[model samples]
Target chain A: MGSHAERKRRDGAQPSARVPSASPAAAHAHRESMPDGAAPAVPGLIRLQPSSVRAAAQTPLHLLPCEIQHNGPAAVSRFFSPAIRPGSSGPVVSFRGRSLHGEEVTLPSGYMGLVLREDKSEGPEDRTVQAIGTFSCFTLWGLEAPPGPNARMHRALSWPSLATAIHAPVAEEDD
Target chain B: MLSHKKRPAEVHCDQWVLVAPESVTDLPGKTENGPVFTRLHNPRTGEAALYLFDTNAQQLFEVKAFHEEFHSWFIGQTVQHDGRLLLVTPVDPLFMVLYYLIKAEKEQGKFQPLDQVVIDAEFPSCSMLLQCAKLRPFLHHVTEEKEIGNKKFYKYSKEKTLKWLNKKVGQTVRALKIGNVNVGARVSSATFVPGDHGSDVKEEDYICYAHGLISEYIPKELSADLAKYLKLPELSASLPEPPLKKRKVSDGPVEAEEDYTKFNRVDLKTKKTNSKMTAAQKALARVDKSGMRSISTFFGTKAKAGK
Candidate 1:
């Protein structure tokens, strides 16, 4: 049974290699190589559906939220984190304390974290972590694990508690 | 818990960048590269610092490190950014009025709203006014005329308005050049130059002409010689009415008994003595009586003995 499973895995890998080689450019060249033939004429008797006409019209691209993947720290240093490897399927994991629509989240102890979002909104990006006091780094969901040595030690904190600590009004001293 | 004094070198330039509007993302997820930030040059301090705005974060950051490290000279002058001029000074009523006036002009399509109010209101000295005048001719050439009043009364366009303002300033400078008004003096002199024809004259010549005209207009108290050159009327005719006659009082020897307290003592005593008598008795007593609302009116009748 184990040998059969291994054989199946090897076959699957071979098909994947051939699939990438069938490029659009190669197909186009193959079509050009064929002998010229008279194309079949369309019949005027058939009426085109309005849905087909509508489909031909250009529609503005509607940006939609897709999968979010956690990339390693090397990717994070390059400003790409939890790398959403292209074609992955799952909603992206959002940062805590940051607004969903993109706005600034002031961190405690004068620390400020900026969450960059796909949606362009005036003002700050949503979700923010003002200041994670005494923590080097925090955990994000769906990440395999904290990235290597460089990933600072961070404490996972609730959004509200972090906000309360950061935005707490300063008390005045009696002179 | 690391605390360090933020020095100029320690200032994080990366945090100071100004965010461009379009690079924002729609999802709640984080982006690796945010919008670009630009550092502004502080002319006074000769320092540069970064600026940024994050829409997703809805926060403006002026990175403390930058503020601590750099010397900023943005004290009095206004700063321009993102299609708006940031006024550094506190908004006073006078500034508010001027701001609205400029806003009105902008709404009328005459001037760009974002243009800085270049006129330095602090200490508008004469030298500055003169400098403004030096730029007048160029201003006048660039001024465009616009119809303002009924029957097409021509007025200066924004360019023309600025130009005329510059020329008026130059005229002031020329007027100051002549020995009419001293620098720092509270007083100002007005000059008028006649339109000259058939003469090749430089701009300096116009200044000289203006100076001479202003000198001529100076009040006679300041320059009698200037008054003579202008041939102004010397004096006005006097009125012909005679002075009024004086009145005289007699110095008499009839020697009527002089009782200085006659009215107060005798009259009041007589009135008190006759209080029991009827109204007929008071009417019969011969006291020079007159009804007056106040004591001042009664005493006002008597003049000083010498006068």
Candidate 2:
């Protein structure tokens, strides 16, 4: 009775394709350039891109200003919420934060990008929102912000004095 | 004449004009004792020479300075064109802006917004573009003005600037090109040779001090070691070991005293009648003070009693 026909049918179904997590270039290169002694290239093995190599190798964990605290065991949600939009100039992403009401509020600007994860298995909860960017513009490149201890502290960029140096007015789309 | 030949260290590595050494001395330029003024040319063509005269010593200094100033932007390889040298340095607009941003921040030791930095770096055009929000997509931290006294100033965050610069440099490097010269070649080509200043000097001296192939004399082993150093992981700063965290000693009782209060303070002088004796007494009690408990104890007799 426990081993029903439905379970058997599910078991017999074909497994889904193995999706690579790395960029297509990196993934393709990984397959082409396998080191003799290294293990078979898994999804997140060695990063070969110069920029990625620098990011992984040069930046020590301590130098990053992000605060990463243990947010208890993870929880799961049914839907996959996308954090970014592919716009004309670049990808735009909203910085998600909890207002005083504990409701999620999306900040309009001043954030680099968002990192969204598909909640496939109803496992643990995670910090799905990774808002990290430069003082200039993180949204342009759709880059993962440097790991931060907290999203709120890292997302803010106020330039009160910058007005003096600015010779031109901000151009609006409608104008 | 062979003895007059200079060592590789004395030879500059930038695009040389192949002039005789005397042309540098003959120029009616700045102070004679100081560095002689020379031309900065396109690394590829050596044809588009900038009239801006830079000091010869400064050129040598700038190469090292560039190594230090924009180490992140520098690719450290050169391409040769028609036997002249050109540095395949990053010429990206983003790179230039980032350089100015970092330079301004470092010099002022304060946060500088895009506008302020553009003015300080003399990139007024870039400043206008920034205000126009042309670079809006790339920027993350810019905000509205905060009025202080009569001045309206904007503060840029260091972390954001740094993050942006790092990403820009990386992206720029990926698409960087230097004419048709092969990537990773030993030396790059120069665009222009200095107009012969009617001096009896070699073109190499006219451009800058460091000469080509003349540096080949550098021991191969030393050069190889240097090459290894260039490839070795770059340390952003030679950070001295962080100063030891200062222990704040106040009028409060010592930490040991606090521990004593946490538990029952055992007095060693007290003759504990139970098994829970003070640690000092326990250790002392474990010692055979009688001395007779030594070898005599093994023999089942005291040393004095045995005698």
Candidate 3:
């Protein structure tokens, strides 16, 4: 993962990779060194690669109870994927000796989960994130027992209908 | 517990994994004609927001990214550091146009051609709003129009606009009912199930809730007018604490009173997000909080206490 990401950056094939937290000072310095010499601003809209954005294969995911500090490749398939077993109540797994309770959660209908990739290349125009992938479900892991109604992810998922209610179009003319 | 056949090298690039309307993948025939992403004035707050205009600029979509702390995404073979889930939903383009129309009302304070009223040097692309197909059909909802010598002119009409907005609240109220959204339940945590306890919530609560959602799309002043038009009651003082103070952008030590996705309006590369964060949030933004427990930890304690 890192090698390809690095190769893309080196090859100037920067996609719309979102750099979340480059402090003002660091971004300011980087801006000075940047060849185009402009602020490395995240564009307002991520250009979608129309050619590649078809139905993608279902991607497996795990919502861990604890956060992992690192942000790169891991042997999820080799060490972790094989361990997800169908427990009596739900799926069960263990990582680092702690039992993880899991439940499969699907996004509410009409919504699709996406994995969008971008890069650090410069001289930008229509920067893209076509390493694009999609999913509709993931296994949410909790400690001891899987999260129920109280999980934040569940609450967050409930936001869409409200958003629909909020942004849903009104009549062009009132009777 | 962990094994690596070949650990991948350090990836410097960041990834954005989000949940968007399935229709986002729908592209027009021309590649150059895919959804046009641009910044538009958020009518409610007068702030710039990232918006996408569908091909032909007929429909508007707001990219909403819900955020929580210390979260990241593990894509197929890679890990994305940012954890917020983005959503793109159709938004009424007229709400965006209203920002400019209201501004023109305040500045020129007179009826003007739509083209002249919609101009904004700050967001040069805002002119694209003039091209939206719905602009003509829906312009009458918020404005009074007059035809003179085959040319049509318009002026922002507060009365008409408020009535239109009231209808918006009414429809939203009906939708909340249809969706069984528990409007009375304060979403204080993820464990909050709408119907679980907020069931006895009043009809006023539904109207108020819908009003709040609609308020996010119009100016605060107009939102107040809509509230008056709807005759919605003031937030009763019966709650546990004082109402959250609404602060101006320059005010000091303002709490982040609402959604974390306010970052959607900001340039992601820069850290000075328009976030009016509290000390804890400010600290949270700077810290590297890997290995930290998620909100589920709190759930454990809550369950233990309940048992």
Candidate 4:
């Protein structure tokens, strides 16, 4: 029975590769059977809606509550705990603050687990952090950021607090 | 002094001045002598000018009436006619009165209500009397209505009446060259030519009155002009700051008398002298008057023992 289940699992992985290469005619026929074109319900594989994805992408950093700290011997100066990487296009999984010249510093992880890259897409000069990403998580250490400023971190998948977000019911859309 | 060399032939009254009304001419002759060349004295310039007038001209009908009513008599010449004293002149004195009225109107560039008396008094000499007389008939007194106790009073329009009077009098005025320009004098076309008598117009010297200029170093010519320009003569006497306006010291220090009635202390003193009271009543009265005693004093051991 274990050997048969393993074979079924391998078969499922093969069909996923075929799903991308499927012809439009095949998708049309398959869509007619489902009618709604909804993906088959799967655990932990919930497809993010395009509207939700857009909302996540456009979320501003100032909206997030962050830990502020005054480090150094006297604690006279203050700075954000997750060192703000100013002038970045979006949330970058950088380990250090951005220099005055806008180049990311090569310092060791001075930031907390979370990294908030300053959203310079609006006001390029502003230092306020707008979007967020995990700099180094247990599962995401050494993970490279995707190319381009448009790459957005999915909050439901990235944040532990939002673990139940995938289980939340999606309102069925007819069109 | 009268000029006798190549004297210009004297023109008749009709040619030189506005003719008198026919009413004046129709009057019966009262003076034996027709007219005479009378000398009129001008108090302002001391010009003893002569004018030809007859016995009729010396009569006070025109002069006395104008003088007693509104205009001044200072402009009239004193003349003796037929054993009677008269203030008269051949050139109508009213001409000068009108010229001044017109002049005052032009100065402020607005029509002003004027009294005929004020015009005559202000300009007493009539050098341009003949010129003004010729223009006088054209002038008319504008009646202005002023409410006084429900009655409307008529006043002459000083500027408007004079302008209207001189409208036909011809703008050109011819008079003797008297160095000083009169009210009605017009500029002749003749340009001033500097003759051998030095420069008729002296050139003003240039002087720098800027900072660091020394008074002693200033040029003599410029210093004179600067002094004249600034009218320094009036400020020549330094008045030592008027001695700082010393306060007037009189007999003694004056103290204002205090009035006890203002504080009602007089009535309180009278009440104290007139009324008698027991010790308790006196204490109560003291408390009422001064409010300085404590209520604890009234409830003391001695007062309770007495009760």
Q: Model 2: residues >4 Å from true position, as ranges?
A: A1-175, B1-4, B8-84, B88-90, B93-154, B162-166, B169-307
Best by TM-score: 3
Residue-level lDDT tens digits of model 2 in B1-307: 0122221111111122111112211234333332211122222121111111112322110000000000010011111011111111111222223444444555774644556765522112233224322243434322233556765544444544433333332322222211111111111221111231223333222111111110111222322332233232222110100000001132121211111110111222232543333222232222221111111111111111111
Off by over 4 Å in 1: A1-106, A109-175, B1-34, B42-46, B55-60, B66-112, B115-307
Task: State the DockQ of every prediction.
Answer: 0.00, 0.01, 0.21, 0.00
* Models sorted by DockQ, best on top: 3, 2, 1, 4
Predicted candidate 4 versus true structure: per-residue lDDT over A1-175, tens digit per residue: 1232343344333321111111222111211111112322220011111221122221111211111111112111133224434344434333223221111211122212222122222221111222122222211111133222111112111111111111111222232
Instruction: Return the DockQ of model 2.
Output: 0.01
**Candidate 4 residues B1-307, lDDT tens each?**
2211210011000000011212222223342222222223221122222232323333211110000000000001110000101111123333334434434544653444334323333223232233332223323432233556754333345444333223212111111011111111011212221121122211111011110011111222323433454343421221110111110121111100111011112223333552332221121122121110111111111111121
- Which residue runs of candidate 3 sit more than 4 Å off their true CA positions? A1-45, A119-122, A172-175, B1-13, B28-32, B185-191, B197-199, B235-259, B262-307
Model 4, which residues run further than 4 Å from truth? A1-175, B1-30, B33-49, B52-94, B102-166, B169-307
Q: Please state the CAPRI-style docking class of candidate 1.
A: incorrect
For model 3, the DockQ equals 0.21
Q: Positional deviation of B173 in candidate 1, in angstroms?
A: 46
What ranking of all candidate models by TM-score puts the best one first? 3, 2, 4, 1
Give lDDT tens digits, candidate 3, residues B237-289: 21111121222241221111122432322222223542333221221232211
The TM-score, computed over Cα atoms with residue i paired to residue i, of candidate 4 is 0.16
Local distance difference test, per candidate? 0.21, 0.21, 0.56, 0.21
The true-versus-predicted C-alpha distance at residue B223 of model 3, in Å, is: 1.4
- Tens-place lDDT digits, model 1, residues A102-169: 11112223222221111112112221111111111122222222222211111111111222222222
In model 4, the clashing pairs are A61-A130, B34-B54, B35-B54, B36-B53, B138-B165, B139-B165
